[model samples]
Target chain A: MQQRTILSTIEGHAAADPARVFCRFQTGAGTEAIGYADLLRRAEGFAGAFAAAGIGRQDTVIVILQHRPELLYGFFGAMRLGAVPAFMPFPSPKQDHALFWSSHRKLLALTGIRFILTYRAIAAGIDEHFTGLDVRVLYVEDILEGLAAGTVPPAPPAPAIAPEDVAFLQHSSGTTGLKKGVMLSHAAVLRQIDRYAGVLGFGPGDVVVSWLPLYHDMGLISCLMMTAVTGAELVCMDAFEWVRRPTMLLDAIEQHRGTFAYLPNFAFLHIARAARPGQRWDLGSLRALVNCSEPCKPQSFDAFLAAFGDCGIGRGTLQVCYAMAENVFAVSQTTPGQPVASLDLDVEALESEARIVPAAPGRDSRQVLSCGRPLPGAEVRILDGAGGDAAPDLAGQIAIRTDCLFTGYNHLPELTAEKLVDGWYRTGDLGFLHAGELYVLGRQDDLMIVYGRNYYAHNIEEVVTACDGIAPGRVVAFAVESRQMGTREAVVLLEPDGTREAAELRRAVKARVFDVLGLTLQHVEVVPRNSLVKSTAGKISRDQNRRRYMEERAGNG
Target chain B: MADEESFREVAQAIGETLMVDPATITRATTADDVNGWDSVTHSMLVMEIERRLGIQLPMDKVFDLADVGELVDLVAAARSAG
Candidate 1:
């Protein structure tokens, strides 16, 4: 059953136990599941159609399906044809169509993805955007019917897939509006599934329950791919449905007797905050509740433990991990079946000097969570300003050299060269090594993580400028930490000319930005154009604006 | 445009929910013309209006609603027809 390629690993599982249920999800009427054999057969059927329509090796297919069961079929079906599939999140019901089209147009043109595989719901509006680009659009629902009628295809043999061939493309959300597509090969992906699963102690008996979006690294690799390769059962739920009612996660786990689930820190805090009185969950069945994808907050940990303490969810079940898509998935994850590692560091040194020192009583101290040691064959280094390995106590840029490093950015070789150096990928995250453990600080750049999703400052600023009446390109947006929200929230600062009411302008900026990004606005301040601090390059600096906003808020309080 | 009575009542409710000037929300208050009519608040706005008016609004109907005027007309139609 040991295999290196993702295709062979799933095939092996099916070869051993055809009827073994791999993925289960909620349907409109009830629950639906696909056994390993059924999955392979269905994937082959979909692949037959892909082959019939001239969609096979050497083609990059764009997949933008929702969290329905069809998403799984679309992904593996493309893979069955040896075609590389790149996933993009399904457009939100509330998304602004114009902005959505323009943003993705750049991605499509860059990656040269000519085939877009989507369902009927999103295919209608998005189809309009793909015209004039010489792209081919394929609808999944239509193809499935074509297969039933035996009119559209004759299934072709699975092509010979190489281990070093690019399996999929993962997009990295950079600090600005530029989303870089990271190309991961089959070997790199298989290596991650083996290394990370071993380190996390995932075995066949374990069952995974996840509601993360399939387009994301955590959702696609850790939750779906790893679980499949490990032969563990999975209970998949729709990400949109899960967010509307986070408690449904706990409810699903109890119903399915699920033993494992992974989420970002915000989901933990949100679930705790959103819990209603008199509601109960039998969380004792959970053996591992991993927190990843975002910075682990000590506040979130305490809040979650305190709230879920009533539901028989004990300590030592929660774990945190630090990961990025550039490495295919997990760089370092905490040991499973253990409580989160907490450390108290001197706040002054952490903030001012980027040093980690034991906190003394009566001195300013802060608590941070540990993200564990590097996986086997994975090297982690905290490179100081001089590009040398930093001391254990000193914080610097987090860098990694792993066997599972991505091949390169899809077509932007210059960007690829800038990120990867001497077989090492320079992760933009900043952290320090202590006691042979990784304690990641926040990102070194202006990129902010809200609700476990990356939102860039300038990206929000771009949307803000598009609003009427406010001066375009004179807007500054930044992430402001709100104690009330328990996470960072987007704040848009508009430089208006005093013609518009400050209150009205603030509301307008907040509404329009949210319309574009689906992020709830924390605060919006209208100041004179002269007040904004410009960088040496004559652009408004997010760091300076954020600093000024925090100081002014403190003064006002 | 909605009826005068429905317009005034729904306008006040929309203004209160969005924390804006009650007098400003009128028939011509389009999403672009207003600041707080962004996507995240659009759902909340619909939910609030539905709750206050005691009428359920299908989100599909929202796709066609461009301004406060459209929202008021839809609410009036739903109330009258139901």
Candidate 2:
């Protein structure tokens, strides 16, 4: 095989099979099939628009468009000029526009982004917050409306790109909160796609139906990059629309004979709940629906199976993948057409001692689903608190050394050094190796995964502390598992600065958190000034406060 | 359905989903006025309203509701359309 960059590989595919459909984009209007050649040509038009604005190989462009054809074209167009492109979420209708755009000032400053490709309305929104920031905003309408069919302005000469050069940056956060740009090189991304696609038996005939946002790794790497690399077909819908109409995924799968999909555990529950009774689809065409991103819950899979078993879901249909953006995508994935393994462990031993012990019959046990074996070039290590290897089946911080490991965090060299030690990247996730497979526990840090998005405890605490009637440094934020919802819900506890109505205080905290962070706090309680627990270091301990909160709730019940 | 009847039904659904007092839910009540009425709960509340009113509201119009009054009007409109 000839060595190729991502752009060359896609361009090669387009040259070889110009008429092959690459993507079927679905929206409120209708589905539009874009062939390989048409997709690339449109991308080149975007490249021309970028080049006319003096954007080239060295500049970084941030794409802030919604889930539309232009989002895809603008992303690839920037890459077409050998420039690094990053996808960012647009402001949701629920979010305040000024707050949303202001939140990205740090990101814009840190990434040195010189160009932002967005729509006119969003460009107007960004202009208010980003004045004097040395950034240029390019509107899609202005760029595309000027170019008629067969009259695209010629792009400048393509820059020669090496495989090891930074291809793009994938940010973990969406519109608000913490943002870390995990930079992946072209070689690393292509290598990851090759291995991951091989494990899933993916081919050009396979059709991926997804509603995942392109900013996330699961969508960017797995759905978009894989299809672009393997010349497979993709059926995609707007993620926001899918959230409101969860059944659209099923409809697309059945209509397109879709072979695969990747979803977080919460989506399985969301779709199942939205489906009315006796409503079903012919889902026999699907080869797998891999649960990923968040901690894969056995109960979520069970709920999905119970809901759709008669509609062609089988025991081997639901799979699991333990993945992160640092590895480009999948670290471990369950085999296709095989039932995922499960273990019943002693809940007390696992939670209290951090040891994996098989449960005795008729005892309290936690059912854990295996995120099968690692991809060919990836190695998993369990590290104890002492930074040494932990014994097998014992919980520790999960570390991985992989051929496709990320280059580093984009511009934070210190953060890169702190996370990637030697040749191994220490994932702040806690998990264990059992029977040659990975069983992921929850996060070891103060990070919480809600609906597969990461938010730090201190971030939420900071928002609450800034609100009225809340004491500074007196708010503690944590997550509680909701089995019914198949996800984690954030809970906030705070001590008030004065005597305020409890309802008013709670309402204020929730509203402020939503306004500032674009997330809802499930529970907000105002406690006494000194009621929160502290660690030995005199810092507020999220773990202890979470345990105390759970105990009090149990007692109340 | 009468406008008053629709308001009461919508308030009941929102109250049940958010665990708030139904009496306190007024036409002016927005998501910011009640705790736990975030986007996710908003979808669940819409479904509950659909179940109660026996009318399927369009998904596009269901989002971006300004207040409980808007939601009640949406439900009443859906009932007539169906």
lDDT of candidate 2 over A174-245, digit per residue (tens): 334358888888999999999999999998999999999998888898899999999999999998888888
What residue runs in model 2 are displaced by over 4 Å at the alpha carbon?
A149-152, A174-178, A499-508, B15-28, B33-35
| Best candidate according to DockQ | 2
TM-score of each: 0.86, 0.95
**Per-residue lDDT of candidate 1, residues A1-557 (tens digit):** 23367888888899998889988877444678888787888888888878887897958887888777777777888888889887877767766655665567766776677887877655557657766786778888888898789876766877788899899887766411267878999999988888988887777777889988877898888888887888888898877656555777898899888888888887886677556667788988787788888788878777888889777676678888888889998888788777777789899988899988889998898888999888898999899988899887799999999999999988889988988989889998999877778888888877888767888776777777877768657788888765544566677777886668877777677666655566656667788877888899998888888898889878966
Flag regions of model 1 displaced more than 4 Å: A1-3, A125-128, A174-177, A466-468, A497-520, A535-538, B1-82
Clashing pairs in 1: A507-B35, A508-B35, A511-B38, A515-B39
TM-score of 1: 0.86
Local distance difference test, each candidate? 0.78, 0.87
Error of 1 at A516 (Å): 4.9
Which one wins on lDDT? Answer: 2
